[model samples]
Structures are given as structure tokens and as C-alpha cells.
Target: MQGIATQLKETPEGQISLTDPDARSMATYGKGTGLVGYNVQTAVDTVTHLIVAHDVTNIVHDRAQLAPMAKMAKAALQAESLNAIAD
Candidate 1:
């Protein structure tokens, strides 16, 4: 308990995942429901249907993900102006 407390104190989030170091407590699409997982961001090309850019975050919410992913996809394609859509 003391060792875990020490580690948690050193952690930025003040919490630690003993099972999976990279995993985090994240909220899901359903209300009042959540899971321990990771948020994966991926940008896919329309024509090729291939993933152009990818990233991962421990963040629980995805509201701030679209713009960054769009920029990544745009930069990867080297396009002057690109259209990004998300549901």
C-alpha cells in the first residue's frame, strides 16, 4: 500500500493502473457507463480508405480530438484544404 501510494503521488493523474500501465478510466458513449481503456485517434483517407494518421491518448473525453486528427490527416495528405467529417 505504501509503495502504490508513493507511485500514485508521483503520477500526474494521482492514480495508477496496476493491470495495464497505459490504460485509463474512460467514459463511453452510454450514459453512466465507463471502462478502463484508451482513446485511439485515427485519420483515414477517403479514396484509399487507408489510415493516414493515428494517435492514442489516455483522455476520457473525445470532444477535443476531431480538430487535431483533421490537421494530422490534412498534413499527411499534403493538401491545401481538406474536408474532415466525424459522426
Candidate 2:
């Protein structure tokens, strides 16, 4: 148990998964409900309806990922200025 506790302290979220080291706890839409997994963020082209930029992360909160994803999409599309829509 001490070994597991040590590992948990090393992680930013203070949790560790023995099954998948990279996986992290992610909360769902329901209260007190969550799962251990990764979050995938994608930036799709509105005009072409194709994926422009994508990323996978163990971090749970997606609210902070909007700007980074938008920038990556803009670079991938090679656009001078771009509009972003995120939920």
C-alpha cells in the first residue's frame, strides 16, 4: 500500500491506476459518477468537416483545452485568423 501511495503522490491529481498508468479519473455528466480514462479533444474544420487537430490527455478538465486546441487547428489549417467554437 505504501508503494501505491507513493505513486499517487507523484501524480498531479493525487491518484494512480495500477491497470493503466496513463489513465486518470474523469467525471461524467452525472453527479458522483466518473471513470478512469483519457480525454480526447479534436478540432474539426467547419468548411471541410474533417479533423484538423486532435489530442489525447489524462487530465480531466476540458475547459482549459480550448485555446490550445484552437491554436493547433489554426496552425494545421495554415490560416491567418480562425474562428473557434467549443462547448
Name the candidate that leads on TM-score: 2
Clashes of 1: 0
The per-residue C-alpha lDDT of model 2 at residue 22 equals 91
Backbone clashes, each candidate: 0, 0
Residue-wise C-alpha lDDT for candidate 2, range 31-87, written one tens digit per residue: 988899999999999999999999999978988999999999999999999999988
Worst-scoring 10-residue span by lDDT in model 1: 25-34
TM-score for each of the candidates: 0.75, 0.89
Stretches > 4 Å off in candidate 2: none
Model 2 poorest 10 in a row by lDDT: 7-16
> Each model's C-alpha lDDT?
0.89, 0.92
